[model samples]
Target chain A: MRADTEQDILKTELWWTALVTAVVTAIMLAIIYAGLVHHINPPSNIETVDPKTLHLTGEFTEGNLGTRVDGSQITSRIVATQFAFQPQCIVMPANRTVTLRFATPDVIHGILVTGTNVNTMIIPGYVSQVHTVFTKTGDLLMPCHEFCGLGHSQMWATVRVVPEDEFKPGPDGRVTCDAR
Target chain B: MALAPHPNYSAQVPPRVDDAVDDVALERVMREVPSGALALSLLTVGLLLLAWFLMYAFVFLPRGMVG
Candidate 1:
């Protein structure tokens, strides 16, 4: 036994435990907040498109199967068919907001960008749209997540996010990975 | 006057305790933690923070938007 001050005797182990728990909780909350506001995993916007005649006309035509830069926003159009994503290698500039538009002329399929939160279900007769900004410059692998057919394992694409200084768009506003 | 020692029982001696030596050993064990252990813990925390920051800035940020 040892002598103790009256005020010091009032403190207990519970106080220390609560303080430690509060610090841990605060750290977890901060991480979650940072993840939510950082625009890493964006939500998908779905719209109806006629699957039977999607290739006939409109923006999903074969000529517009890749990325097209508009006034301020960049739009990427992709057609997910039986076993491949048309224009497997799409190009975009890093650190810029981009609209990713996907449509399937066949059955339902899902797309997920590896190392990213960009995941959406590409269903026939509908368009899956996602708007996001690329912050890093590299090749991002995009694979079909949903099972479509026997060759589903081979259905994948690459998205090249080039640095803004290196991105070169042609007079027609078309960009592809091979252009680099 | 009426009590007698049991034949099966034997008197035992108490173990010797040196108060000064025992107190010193106890204080050394309980008073402070090793400086190396504390430094290692802090270093681990710093490394964890660094890894988290790098992953967030490079990997997560560059992957682009989902919504």
Candidate 2:
């Protein structure tokens, strides 16, 4: 009887521990779910693309890469190849939805923007996409998180989050940081 | 109750403060509603959640997006 009582007590304590653990885990999951549904968290929509000739044609061409803003729609396309990003910097307006798309022509690369939720892997044959809004106006660093080659340390870009008033596109609806 | 006469304090047996606590004592402690261990765990978890929420709302969301 004594042993049974001791066992019961141990079991009870375990139950309490388990219950608290469950509660904590559930709360964490709920927060993540809310973040995802609200678009405040970084998301990945992986799609395949040709790596051998990404820059030679398609949306990532020399004249096609950059921020394109239409009525309530803004898209930015970039090509990641070798040791540098094709368009080192792209100008975007703060507090607006921006779809950043990336494709790699060589080895794998990962993009991580400092102080933001934009992180995506750039596979050689895949297109990585992330949509987010910049609340603060500043120059954010975009570094190649994956080691590409000898120049991997210097492989970086910039996302110039300009103010709404400062983000002016040409008549052709293209915005580049170089335009400033 | 009558007070006992004082004897040689050093000669008297010393009280054992850290006596061996048996299963009975442990069982008694665990059987109590809102046991101390449970209270401590609850408090820790609550504080952690509070910190997480604060960081998420104030620091993370305000930093904005890649756009």
Candidate 3:
């Protein structure tokens, strides 16, 4: 009777162990596959833009600006600081596609374009790309959201959106501000 | 030996149990967390998430036209 009871207990423990091991293994495998495989082959970069595309390269650094007119401290907001490109001055054609790639010369930076609902983080060694379809013609602001250093709150970029015909033509027939 | 009065015959025994289960083994097993391991785990997870997002952008989605 004692041996039988011990055998039953051992069998129960063994079954539980097996079940737990299988569950744990499945979870680990799923995490690995999702992180390693999915990350290497994300779906965003495969899309391409047509000719006459505006290719702009921007570098962001930490700098400071004064407060607002109302005496409201603009420096208090996370989005108010840190910008390599002035988003408000970025001129783009309405009803067209635009691509913006962000890079940092020193530290990690994050670009947040509030008007068009675009956000991306850029690292020192990595180039982050943002693609947007500008369906409207208006002024916008692009601010840095990353908490880099003391000057992080002052980084700002300008974006200007103009009509398709009004875009300035580059020497290479590309509507780019910077030479490719 | 005859006791004069043992409290009440119908009264229950004292609440204090006669024996307690020792858990020294379990305690020893639980105290082995390595330093900075949690932070490292979080960093790993963040990097992994970033990699996955990039892959999803560059690979899985169709690259033809804007909807």
Each model's lDDT? 0.78, 0.81, 0.47
TM-score of 3: 0.39
> What lDDT tens digits, residue by residue, belong to model 1 across residues A1-180?
123332233343445456557657866775575568765444546579999888898889999889888777789999998899998989988878788899999999999877666888999988898877777779999999999999999999999989988887889888877777
Please give, for residues B1-67, the per-residue lDDT of candidate 1 as tens digits: 9779776455464666765667556555543444454466558866876787788667765654557
Residue A65 miss distance in model 3 (angstroms): 22
Model 1 global lDDT (CA atoms, 0 to 1): 0.78
* Model 3 DockQ vs. reference: 0.04
Tens digits of per-residue lDDT for model 2, A1-180: 367766776887789878878877877875675576554654557678777778787887889898988877888998887799979998889888888999988899999888877888888888888988877788999999999999999999999999998888899999988788
Chain B TM for prediction 3: 0.37
| TM-scores, all models, native as reference | 0.61, 0.73, 0.39
Query: What is the CAPRI rating of model 2's predicted complex?
Result: incorrect
**What is residue A91's positional error in candidate 1, in angstroms?**
0.3
Give the runs in model 1 whose Cα sits over 4 Å from its true position.
A1-36, A40-42, B1-64
Alpha-carbon runs more than 4 Å astray in model 2:
A1-5, B1-51, B64-67
